[model samples]
Target: MASKLTGTVALVTGASSGIGVDAARQLAEQGAAVALVARRKERLETLAAEITEAGGTALAVEADITDRDQAEAAVRQTVERFGRLDILVNNAGLMLLGPVVGADPREWERMIAVNVQGLLHTTHAALPHLLKAAEEGPRQVADIVNISSIAGRQAWENYGVYNLTKFGVNGFTESLRQELAGRHVRVGVLEPGAVDTELGSHNNATIHAEMLDPFNAQHERLVPADIADGITYMVTRPRRTAIAELWVMPTDQA
Candidate 1:
C-alpha cells in the first residue's frame, strides 16, 4: 500500500534536536522527501544520513531561521532538492524560565528571536512553495504546523516570556489559517505540555533546579515522537478536513 505522503515534500526547522528531529523522521517514513533545517550542520547531516540509511529521502539544510535571508534560502534549497514543498513544521524555539523581576534581558531577546522571529521568517519563505504545492502537487492540500506549547494557552509565573511567545504563535497560526483557507494551505498549531526534550536545558542552573527539575520528576512528560505523531496526523488528514489546534499533554499532567 502507498504511504500517506508518498509524493510530498516537507521541511522541518530546528531539525538538529528534540521534536524537530523526530518530526522529520516521521515525515520521511510516510514517504515524503524531508529537508532538515537547523543551525547545527553536523547534527542535521547525521540525521539526514540516518533517514537515508532507513530507506527514506532526507536533506540537511543548515540555517539559522532567525535570519530572514537564511530562512528563505533554506526554503529555496528544500524546493530545489525535492521539486515541491507540501509541509512545513516550524519547530524551532527556546524556553528560558525565570522570574521576570531579576531575569537577564538577553534571555528574553533569545526567546523572542527564535520563537517568534524565526517562525515568522521560515513561514514567510515556505508559504509560496506550499501554496504552489497545493495547486500543482499530487495532494490538493498543503500543511503548516507550528509547534507551540501549553504555555500559549495558560500563564505561569516563571514562564512569562516563553508564554508570550507561544501565545503569539497560537494567535498567528489562527489568523493565518483563516487567510490561507481559500488557498488550501492548512495552518495549525500543536501545543505540547512538558516534553522531556532539550527545550528546557537552556535555562540557568538556578531556574532549572528550582523550576523544571521538580516538575519533571513529578510528571510523566510527553516524548519527541509523541509530538511527531501529532504533526503527522495533522498533515495527513483528508483534504476536506483541517485541524486548527492540537494540545498534547502527558496523561498525568493536570
Candidate 2:
C-alpha cells in the first residue's frame, strides 16, 4: 500500500493560512513530508502540530519569502531535513484593490513584493534541488506550482498593479515550463478566481469595501481546499503528464 507521494518532500510558501495551509496538509496526507514556510511562526507551528498529530511529517520554517537570504535559507532547511525537494507550491501573495489615481503606492509595492518578488526568490532558490530530484528520486519527476490569479489573464478597473504581478507569474511559469520540460521538472500555473480567503483584508477601508462589492460576493467562490485539491491533482500525476497551465476560475466567472 504505497502512497501517491511516498518519499517526496514538498515546500509550501505562505503556509500559515488559507490556500498554503490546505495545500500543505493535502500534500502531507498524500505522504509527502511538508515544509511550511511563512513569517507567522505561531500559525505555522499550529499547522505543523496538527499534521504531526495526524501522522504526517511537517516542519514549520519561519521566513519571509520577500527577502532573498531568508527564502534561500528556507529551501536549505527543507533539503537538510528531507534530503530532497520534489514539490514547491509557491502560494504566497497579497492583493490590494484601488484606483491607480487614488491608490497608495505602498499598497502596490507590497503586492509586487509578495506576489512577484517573493515568488521569484523562492523559485530561484529551489530550481537546482527540483532538477536534481527529477533526475534521481523515487518519483523521477518534480513539480513547481505557481499560484496565480484570474487577474493574470485579464485586467480589471482597480486592479491594475495586482494584474501586473499575476500576469508576471503567468509569463514566468510559461517560460520556466519550457526550460524545465526537458529536464522532467514540471512547471505550472494555477489561476484562481474569487477564492474564499482573507486575501483582501490588507486593503484600506474604502478599497476593502470596493473589493467586497455586492457583485463580487453574490456568487459561490472557490475555497482553499478547492485549490488544494487542484494542486494535489497536479503534483500526483505520473511522470508522463505535465499540467503546464490550469485555469481554476469559478463557474460563474466568464
TM of each candidate vs. truth? 0.98, 0.98
Q: Candidate 1: misplaced stretches above 4 Å? A: none
Residue 226's lDDT within candidate 2 is: 90
Q: To one decimal, what is the Cα RMSD in angstroms of model 1 from the true structure?
A: 0.7
- Residue by residue across 1-254, what tens digits does model 2's lDDT show? 97899999999999998999999999999999999999999999999999999999999999999999999999999999999999999999999887899777988888999999999999999999999999998999999999999999999898899999999999999999999999999999999988888897777787756566665668788889999999999999999999988888788864
Q: Number of clashing residue pairs in every model?
A: 0, 0
The weakest ten consecutive residues by lDDT in model 2 span 208-217
Root-mean-square deviation (CA) per prediction: 0.7, 1.0
Worst 10 residues of 1 by lDDT: 200-209
Q: For residues 1-254, could you state the per-residue lDDT of candidate 1 as single tens digits? A: 98999999999999999999999999999999999999999999999999999999999999999899999999999988889999999999999888899889998999999999999999999998899989986989999999999999999898899999999999999999999999999999999998989998887898878988898999999999999999999999999999999999999995
